[model samples]
Target: MDTTQTAVKLILDRWEASMHNYDVLLQSLSDDQLQKEASPGKNRGVYLLGHLIAVHDSMFPLLNFGEKQYPELTKIFIESPDKAVAELPSVQELRTIWSKQRTSLKEKVDQLKAEDWFGRHTAVSEEDFAKEPHRNKLNIILTRTTHLAYHTGQMIYLK
Candidate 1:
């Protein structure tokens, strides 16, 4: 495989690992624990997973044409949505969504040309990102991939 293809694959591989980790952690939690908040006001694992999906969904607009842009990762940080972390759909439901979304995202990453990797993307450096044109798409993928890891670690503790 060429460099670009390899780079894109690496990102997808790492993200797939992150998703596996999410599954394991969520599985360990008792159904009640699944809903337990990380803190007094924090979200639970179910909420966090939903928030994860929401976070990535936010990127769709930027990835598309930057129409429905938001300030940051979540509405997860905003008032909790009706779907509690515990109250999300069944594991099978989540599994299907997760599988589809990740595959689709990976396919998109694979399609980018070398130049397109840095194509005006503000994913990593949107606000906290340094003021430069260094917004590589791979970097953005890694950034969000790592974010999922961070939350996965937090979810482990909740159980």
Candidate 2:
């Protein structure tokens, strides 16, 4: 494979591995366990899960893939702090959404060519992209992978 292909493969592989690790960690916890905070006064397991989903849902629009599948999640999970919302989707419901959203994102992302990964995402203006080429579609995956891993680490405290 050429350098671009190799780079894309490596980023995608790491992103997938991060997602898998998070899935395994979340699966190990029961629904009741997810209701507890990961640490005292910190975000709950369920809140973290919803927050991750909300962030990932925004990626569709940012990456120019499509509109967000769960725009409502942004208000609850992203805009509001953990207990600020009066209610949240059940843990099981969040799990199902996570699974479906991740699968859909993977399908769309996997279909992109190597060059497509290097192109600017929708969030970047053309003039800015020319000046700052590093802000590309692949960078979103890299950053979001790190974001996932960080929250996954926090969720470990729940166990």
What's each prediction's TM-score?
0.63, 0.98
Report the Cα lDDT for residue 1, model 1. Answer: 85
Clash number by candidate, in order: 3, 0
In the predicted model 2, the residue pairs found to clash are: none
Q: Any idea what lDDT model 2 has?
A: 0.95
Once superposed on the true structure, which residue ranges of model 1 sit more than 4 Å away at CA? 1-12, 39-41, 65-96, 113-115, 122-131
Ten-residue region with minimum lDDT total, candidate 1 = 64-73
- lDDT per residue as tens, model 2, 1-159: 999999999999999999999999989999988999988899999999999999999999988999999999999999999999998999999999999999999999988999999999999999999999999999999999999999999999989
Which numbered prediction scores highest in lDDT against the true structure?
Answer: 2
- Sequence-dependent TM-score of model 2: 0.98
Candidate 1 per-residue C-alpha lDDT over 36-123 given as tens digits, one digit per residue, 9 for 90 to 100: 8776676666667666766766556656534332333254333456353234465455545556665666566556666576555654
lDDT of each: 0.63, 0.95
For candidate 2, the 10 contiguous residues with the lowest summed lDDT are: 32-41
Q: Once superposed on the true structure, which residue ranges of model 2 sit more than 4 Å away at CA?
A: none
**Superposition-based RMSD of candidate 2 using all C-alpha atoms, in angstroms:** 0.6
